[model samples]
Target chain A: MSAAELHNNEMIHGYLNDLRRYLSRLAPHETQEVIREIESHLFDVLDQQAANGQAADVAEILRGFGDARQLAALYVAHIEEGAPPPRGFRAIQSVKKSVTASLYFAMAVFGFSMAFGLLFIAGAKFLLPESVGVWSTPHGDSIVVGFVSVPPMATPEVMGWWIVPVATLLAVGVAWLTRKVLLVLKQHM
Target chain B: MNSTEALMEKWEVQLRKGTLELAILAALQQRTLYGLELLKLLQSLPSTTITEGTLYPLLDRLKRDELVDAQWVQEGETRPRKYYQLTPLGNKKLTDLTRLWRQSVSDIEWLLANPGPQPLPNTGV
Candidate 1:
């Protein structure tokens, strides 16, 4: 490539990197879309300037784009108008956004895992007969593992059939929690 | 620049910002142009001062609002160019906005031409 072409390429690359960092919250596809449009526009401008025998100063070209963050904000505002509003200061908002999203995801994954385990236990308890015992010993003591069952140490009160409905509700709660976690993941993605 | 000139410059910026959407719509009234082509045409005009950052978002807004239609067309060997044109709804909007803008400009011009009442010559009561 010619010196001018190399310089132009460097300038465009630098400007795009600045823009990408500023718009980090955007989905990969969205960021690419914006960058592609910009690259096309800049190259056309530069080519025209070159043809006219004028110097296509990269700094001048970038200035024409205005401030990088401001430009990113404009695109973000336009695209994410339907999404949640960014909070606090401009720079802080991006950091807070990613941090918050990651925290929510982590919490959701933890919640879902806990819920799944609990739901499995509850479901197993519901399926097992009330009198069923995990370990029946010759000493006339039975070890119970049911959701509502008292361990061998605790007072052995017979759990009523109503435990089925209660266990069912707990399973339903876990399912709902799973759905919510999936939604949060989808939105972040 | 002096303070008065600076103040005028500030207001001009504000005024231009407001009219840019209208200007873009007007430009697209007759023909379809790709992003760079449209930018060139607007830059050629003395009144319009726009950059890709401002123009693309506005174009995106217009597209989102269903005021403009866009398509990618490729002629052999070159990159596909995205061209934008006005939708039927956009035409209607442009016609209405143009009328309102013209009326407002005329009113402002009248106020400028005749600076009304010149302090109403000291009516001593």
Candidate 2:
């Protein structure tokens, strides 16, 4: 429509506001610019409609552009393309994110393994008597074997008490080393 | 029409969105202008359009490519505004695009004039 004949300024303002609110929540810094672009696009469409004698109210005509979800997606794409991180920063960020995820996954595995070990100790204590005794290896090293609070003793099937502290320390040591290895891997990758 | 068809049409319109960037660049080639001025010129076009926000990013891309140059100018009682002008590279590209565009127009016109049977022969020329 000709500038002289335009009459829907207030309606256009509101329409732009609605679109702006939807876009702003998706991308804060660039929302105003996005609103301006959508306004210009809507204006062009309204201008064409006016020329065609189909719509007298450009603002009213634009009130129908829906799909808040799609609009949000568009804002995301716009920000992605327009404000991408530097390649170096992106590489570092991705590595950090992956390593952090792997750490959590490994922690879960450690927790489950510890739980199983405790269960085995509990089951052995419940089924077997505390009458076993400590034994000596060929190296003249003495080893103690028993469940929690039971006297040091040996059984052919049950793991030794020494094994408990050793395995716990070893598991902890491996996890700590793995964390360092992950840090090094991230640094190199 | 079904809602799916309406969505498809919207997607179709979005795919045609590249023309807006092309049109904006073409308009900026005519004169050095700030964001609002360039948007105004594009809105004045018969078959092209652009938004205020869209121009900034497109201009940023063009600037990054060294296709356009921008400078901030301060006026007495207003905040400085950035104005953009086509760079030498941009001018060179615009010339190339103009040639290709005009050639396409003429090619389409020739096709319209000489209605062919079945499709134009496989002129591998």
What digit string (tens of lDDT, one per residue) describes model 1 on residues A1-189? 889789879978988999989887776766777788788778777777889999888778788788888998887784455754333235766786788777777877777776676566556654665543343344656545455454444445354555456555766787687778768765774
lDDT of 2 at A82: 67
Interface RMSD of structure candidate 1 (Å): 1.5
Q: What residue runs in model 2 are displaced by over 4 Å at the alpha carbon?
A: A1-20, A32-181, A184-189, B1-18, B43-45, B49-74, B77-82, B86-103, B109-125
Report the poorest 10 consecutive residues by lDDT, candidate 1 chain B: B116-125
Query: Each candidate: what lDDT?
Result: 0.76, 0.60
lDDT at position A33, candidate 2: 53
The 10-residue segment of model 1 chain A with minimum total lDDT is A129-138
Compared with the true structure, model 2 gives a TM-score of 0.43
Q: Per-residue lDDT for A106 in model 1?
A: 80
| lDDT (tens digit, per residue) of candidate 2 on A48-107 | 666898756664445334443455455545346666653434666888788777776676
Error of 1 at A177 (Å): 22
Over 4 Å off in model 1, which ranges? A79-189, B110-125
**Pairs with steric clashes in candidate 2:** A37-B51, A132-A153, A133-A153
